[model samples]
Target chain A: MKQAKYGLLLYIFLALPPVASLMESVMIVHMHMQLTLLVLSGFLMGTFFKQRFASFFNNWNQSGVPGVILAVVIWAYWMIPRIMDETLTMHSIEIFKYISLPFLVGVPLRDSWKKVSYTVKHILYIFMTINFIVMGWIYVAINQQICNNYLLVEQRTLGFGSFAFAACMIIYGFIWIFSERKEHQQSS
Target chain B: MEQTIKETIRYPKKLLGVNPNDAKVSLAYLSVAFISLLIGGLLGLVQGLERAGLIELPSWLNYYQVLTAHGLLLLVVFTATFTVGYQFANLSHSFGGLLPKVRTLAWVGFYLMIIGVGMVVTMIVLNEASVLYTFYPPLAAHPIFYVGLVFVVLGIWACCLGVFINYRHWRKNHPGQVTPLLAFFAMGVFVLWFFASIGVTIEVLTLIPWSMGLVETTNVMVARTLFWWFGHTLVNIWYLVATSAWYVIVPKIIGGRHFSDKLIRLVVILLVILNIPGGFHHQIIDPAISQSIKFLHVFMSLSIAVPSLMTAFAMFAVFERTGRKLGGKGWLGWLKKLPWGDVRFLAPMMAMLAFIPGGAGGIVNTSNQLNQVIHNTMWVVGHFHITVGISVVLTFFGICYWLVPYLSKRKLTPKMNKLGVIQTIIWTVGMMLMSTSMHIVGLMGDPRRTSDTTYGGHEVAASWIPYEMVFAIAATLLLIGVIIQVYAVFHMMFLSPKGQTEFPVAEPEEHAPVAPLWTERWGLWTVLLLAVIAMAYVVPIVDMIMNAPPGSPPIRTW
Candidate 1:
């Protein structure tokens, strides 16, 4: 409950016009820092929602597969260059981004995360890593601007930025798998 | 597990002292460290006197050459080697003994560093490289100088591997147990060191070709951004090392428990995460970086002050608690209970005190408007001199008073302790006179890194001369301080009375909560470190590369 207050504060601050505009003005910040922070806010705020609608989550997110799929689909949609550009131009899409990312992506992801088994969690991580690699290459390799809102240079910056994120994910995966093996060996 | 650790220390091979083989490695590194101090300290004196116009250098020896050697020797060699020595000793003592291969890796690192340092020194002496420690581009060094730096980075990486291996081995063997606090600090230091060097390694790799004329030109902005990526983090690395001693050793010397173990580990985690991005403030005044980005990075730089303030808060609380327990009465009476005469306590105590102004100056340097006033001025020089010279170097000096004796199986005799107290006083007085004058004169418009700023004997310039003379006199005092410190160290290493000296590590308070298991999850911490670095650097670095000015060819300003 106390965490909800902090999350609400973060969400409100990020929602302020100046803050939103400043983050959106930079292409990399829009995709990486700002969006990730938004997801984090909702992840924090999810506890309240989970308690209030405990039965709803438990029924819909049984085995977590359905909720995980919905969250993944929303994230994959947001990764589109056309969708990102549309969010800047269309007021409805902008509002949708704010609401959907937090509730649909973040809150659902949180509810599903605890319900998912070990193999499911790892498979999801592997999926994100592979997805980032393909998207990163497209962003870097494409000749024309993919997002009308940003310049080609910014598009390229986003591409490179995506590559860095993917690199981080890969590194994380390596550490996770490596440490697990070491632990398993010790247990054996 | 705790009882086992205590018993391990109580009945060691040399009667509760460091193993003899491990002691050799630490001693070899410490000897090189002090020898570096001796040469670097003398160079500092000569450079100061020459800059002050009190002495003239021979034609064969130039001021920039001297400055470059002095900076490299003291800032890089002295600090790096000393940290490896002290931290390895801590790791060995905490772990009971180093794994056999870990010791080999340490010696490999030692030899690599020696070979690298030897090449760097020879080039500087031959007048082939006069680029100072920062070695910012457009003014390039000899190709081999960069190569030497590569070797140095490799040596550090080797040691990083050694520590990681030994740490993992410990964790595997003793499941579900937290690492000893001292080893935790060593982990923080090396992790920061390894990541920090990656930037400089990239920078140096680029420079090797540029200096060799294989590459016609290189982006100066990109090069500088990369150097400071390592440069500022390197400062924090030393700061982290100093704080390790403060958090762990200082409390023991004063006969008190350390601050909360959890908070101390959190401090280490926070320092590693927030450190690298703080380097952006060093380029606050540089063009091409947008004002909005600089504005944001100011907070990034100042965020480091959180952990520092925590340390200050924790240390004072420990002092008060210890003092009151020792029978002090009122609010301020606890101050009297502290050991004023013990060199081990007095030197680092002065260091923590020096950081008051030293850290304040750092905040000033981070502020955008304030930085404009002091950027590239002698005030910047004064800032590092106080921060690194007194705050960092003084702590290293303090560590030597015990560490040298403990490793050597020799005692810190009362006579040697008194001499150490005297040495600390002289060093403090010298650094104070030097840095204060520099700060004052810099505000009056004196530039740094210049051999002469007399402006053909102008009146305002002449006012700075008095300050330069203070620098000279202070340098002389400091050289004497250096001599006594070196002599004290070698005496303890070889000539002091043979006896066991305790390797002091402060215990935790009774009934303390178990430090959370999450603190040991360094794999997660390392990922967060990289992610934060990517976020801080991506936009600005991409801008520097994409919208760059024409690259500059290597120039020999000398």
Candidate 2:
């Protein structure tokens, strides 16, 4: 049933670009409608079906191999265009593939994906930490390009937006790591 | 079902650590925050006077100085002190048994934040840092301003660390245990904050090097990108933590179990994930970003409305059930069962009332087309003050009043308590009036961050005269309410008779029934599912990194 919904939503969504050219005065309007519908679908699924979908993934959890595979496929798709000079909407295709890649991660790992076993938890944490470090580096290097030769120093060094988030995350990370250690100490 | 929940209960007498002196410390933060507001308020009055072309003060006490001080002192310093003080009280009760370090850390953090506030104010008065509270760049301020802000962040970081340590200690002592829903919400805020800080930290650390001329140059886009990473997300961090207090306090007061505890926490986790990426929605109008990128952020921003809507659904459900259990019938029954007369109940109720308008404004602003109409206008200010300023700030006050006594072992003076409720009611109503007026004028094309003057001549000026008058009237009412709240809380702490204090009561949970193990186990997985769903929108976006259009702006290697 969920599959049907996903299919229908995608069909209507993908059909819009072609549908848009038919309209003279409201071509942009048609394009907007197509785009907005996809967002609406995402919102409804996240809010209503999150539990069912997440549990389904957990039931099929297999150590993120599939996630890595999906990532490889998307990466290969990008590399093929670069290497072979294939004619394609590279940017559009990239976004579409990224949007679809989640099904790879979501479908096979339903109920069992997020088990609280210490190993799985640690892996997730490490993954997130690495992502942050990478993003942080990207952010730092891009300062000149983004800020126009203005260095990014200020009080509350992280700034209001990022500091609040990082502060929250740091607190969360500290709690998780610290608690894990404490539990280990007790068990030993 | 009843027996199941009862069986999981555990109340430890040893954790009933109540110190009377803590009340004084809590009061001190609130008092100082109020005093800051008072000063800011007077500055606002001057601004109001200046708006009418009636400048009683020297021309040197210019609009820029007042505007900068009003924003920096009132919003950052005052609001934070009040919120953090409430947090100290909450941590003492929520994790009193699980973690014990929060109270000590809170003391240190509170003082650090105060010092930070003092320094910022000094910079403001000295005309050294006039970039306003918003640290958006190319408009850098004095080095002392940055240093002071670091102290503030450090202070907040310490407070957050305190919460984390306590949570960890608690979870360690009780392995495999699911955290209480409220504590999870609080912890989620910490999680969001830690990551959110990274962006600003990048900006600050990177900028300082160049500002001090250590580096040749800094990237403006990168800095703004990082700033918004902090800017947009911090708004949610403030709201999420403050609202968690409401989630706990509201249900208890209404006399019911939370409608769906498992779901509420999931919403919170979703909020954390969705918030991080959605911030780019603010930068949609920037020329450097491609349409697809803006399109992506637009979708993400719109998607965020789900969690908020879910929250409303969940909260209203609890209220509905509470109404039915109280012997009321139908949709209206829920309204009847609510303890309307009780200040504890009324304050949060009013806070919720304010959220409705703010939420509507939020949805409109999140829409790409709609945002273009009101972005960077008084309308934006109206929307935020209604959402974060009123909803979150009021909730902070409600929680303080509700939980402080439990932690401090002293009842709030009854008269002062009454006064607090009255003040909140006035403040909430006044805020709506003011913000609504702001939206009207903003739509009429009034600009933000100005003293109401523009280059389009007096035609634009004439349209604003009535709105400005209405705004002044509303501001006066709001100021009175704010001052009343300060006086009431202070009176409860310092001037109230000490002999009437209530001793601590440690309720025995040994005989209480425990919630079934299966229920708790299921709850944990449900929460985990929430996390997974939260990331679905995000994890896919990672694909954007590898697939770029030919001749697009290339991502620089770090």
Candidate 3:
């Protein structure tokens, strides 16, 4: 956890300083390169780091079949830009996500019927908390603002829809935590 | 407590459980919603007549009024009715018995809502409250409209109260055991609407009253804020209850056990939290709020996709596993093996079908740049028709097919029995054609509210006339489907049976070929948890630093 935090902080520090000008273009490009690597690292951590962080990954795996798919999907969605051209329309990408969703969601439901253990659920909560905390900090640092598109006004924010949905998930998280605690107390 | 019929009438010794009651109440609410749908259908017929110039249309039943009534009635009232009923039904089962007082209150609440809807319809017909039913400023309706609306909100408040009481009762009775999945979701939506009601309640009780000259100095911004509070969360309430019903019904139809009950509960909780604060998404376009706030809202709105995605996953997984276990071979071959004739399977099945177009349209509607071209256009109408209209109405029909026999205690006559599935296919196919045409018409610069054939000084061309004609034709098909439903349900309910009825009890039947392994453990929670994380990553920051403060001045954009 500490190492992850440090790595993120270092990436932020390298990315934030506005030192580059026409004379320092190389350095600016280097900074961009480093920032990309950090995002990549986070993506990997959110996705494949389960192999190395067995306990954490196992706990996360327990969050639910849906959560596991979501984590993978999010990671994959973020990395799409890195791997693909920037010119692709968001609509098309959205379509891709839509098509992929049924398959991703369906895959996990086939194998098991066991309830996600409480310990894994909480561990997932912790991981999500970290991810959000990091993303929130990035949003703050970058001075996030809504685009000037007409849809922005009528639709709310581009990301707000997703965010609102996520908030509902958080509410679920707390409910689970409390329920698990109560169950533990009863058993004890 | 009310001893009126305590002695003479014998209440059943055993109350139905969450699953059965969930089916009953959901179907009952759906039954009502579909009946009300005929009203909307009648309105659509009028629209077709007016558009074709076949009959002179009333000024009050102009495009905007009809559209608003249709939108709010089907999405809000119908959705809310089904949600409230589902909540109570689940409660009845989860609590191990009915809370008679709460049950009675729910019934009264249902009647109150009916009265309110009746009043709204009357006002629309009489040309009394014809300002277009939206939460925007400078348009006012009749005092009766406002009063009737108050009754509507009060009815919802009553329903919410019933849910709370029932949930508390259940918690009291069942100490250590996990709450019923459906009941747990009901509680979540119940909590959501408790807060949801505050905003709309204030708007209906205070702002509209003041606007109607019943009071002075009502805050428009305040009213707008409040309406959206109820408005947006109301969608969540719909999704939550429907999803709960989906969880119960879908697995059963496909011959599958729930992969993870706990995960589904978690998803319900996520839906509640995510759906509430996200109401500000509607305010994104207004200059009254800051650009940053809009950005924040966008993020939250997008985060909602995660759990929705989770639902997609769980549903497919459940169906897949069911299919595989029921002696189905191969990966996708199970799709063919699943039962399609069962009415119970049709309800949740239709919801999945409607979800495809509805969810896609939702993304387009929410996109910042895309909104400019489509906002207030026929495209906007088409989008919601796909989302709210398709999902809710299809589910309504589906629930009917599932529960009519159970509730009516009679076999649907062969004709009546088959009507449900046929009507469903007709409605689904008809809506796709209608909505798709509407979207194309919108893109061709057809404004939504105008009642004339002229746009920007040019009459619609002969080529364009085909789409318009198609819209009317499709509406007729939809009406036929609705009529068939009404005919079938009324016949089944009134003429079917009075004594205990018996039918074949269905076992779990799988639809999808393979079930994902993780569903049992974390399927629902994982999707919901990620969604929450995504939203939390965005909302507070924007609320605090980016969006205008809550009481900021209003800025107008059409």
**What C-alpha lDDT do the candidate models reach, one value each?**
0.90, 0.59, 0.58
What's the distance in Å from true for residue B447, model 1? 0.3
lDDT of 1 by residue, B1-558 (tens): 999765554433332254578888888899999999999999999999998999999999999999999999999999999999999998888888777678899999999999899889999999989998788799988988888898899899999999999888888766767899989999999999999999999999999999999999999998899999999999999999999999999999999999999999999999998999999999998998989889889988999999999999999999999999998789899989999899999999999999999999999999999899999889999999999999999999999999999988899999999999999999999999999999988898899999989899999999999999999999999999999999999999999999978888999999998887678888888988998888788878888898988999999988
Runs in model 1 deviating more than 4 A are A180-188, B1-18
Ranking by DockQ: 1, 3, 2
B1-558, model 2: which lDDT tens digit per residue? 867543322332334324444454556677677787778767766766565444555755657678778877777777667766555544544555423245667778888988888787887788766676676556666667777777788887887788777665555446656566556676777667766776677677766655555665556666667777777788888778666756776777767665455566667767776777667777766545546546656767777788888878777877777788888896596688788766666777777778888888887787778888888778987787788668876776666554545444546666767777787778877778778888888898777777646355587777777776766777778778767866665555555554333322122123444332233222233233333322322222222222322321212111
Candidate 3, B94-126: lDDT as tens digits: 555566677667777888888888887677666
Give the Å shift of residue B222 in candidate 2: 1.9
Worst 10 residues of 1 chain A by lDDT: A179-188
TM-score of each: 0.96, 0.72, 0.68
Best by lDDT: 1
* Docking quality category of candidate 2 according to DockQ thresholds: incorrect
What TM-score is obtained for chain B in each of the predicted models? Answer: 0.97, 0.84, 0.83
> What are the candidates' individual DockQ scores?
0.52, 0.07, 0.13
Error of 2 at B352 (Å): 1.2
State the lDDT of candidate 2 residue by residue for A25-95, as single tens digits: 12112212333343344433432344656564445444544544443344334222121111123456535
lDDT of residue A7 for candidate 3: 41
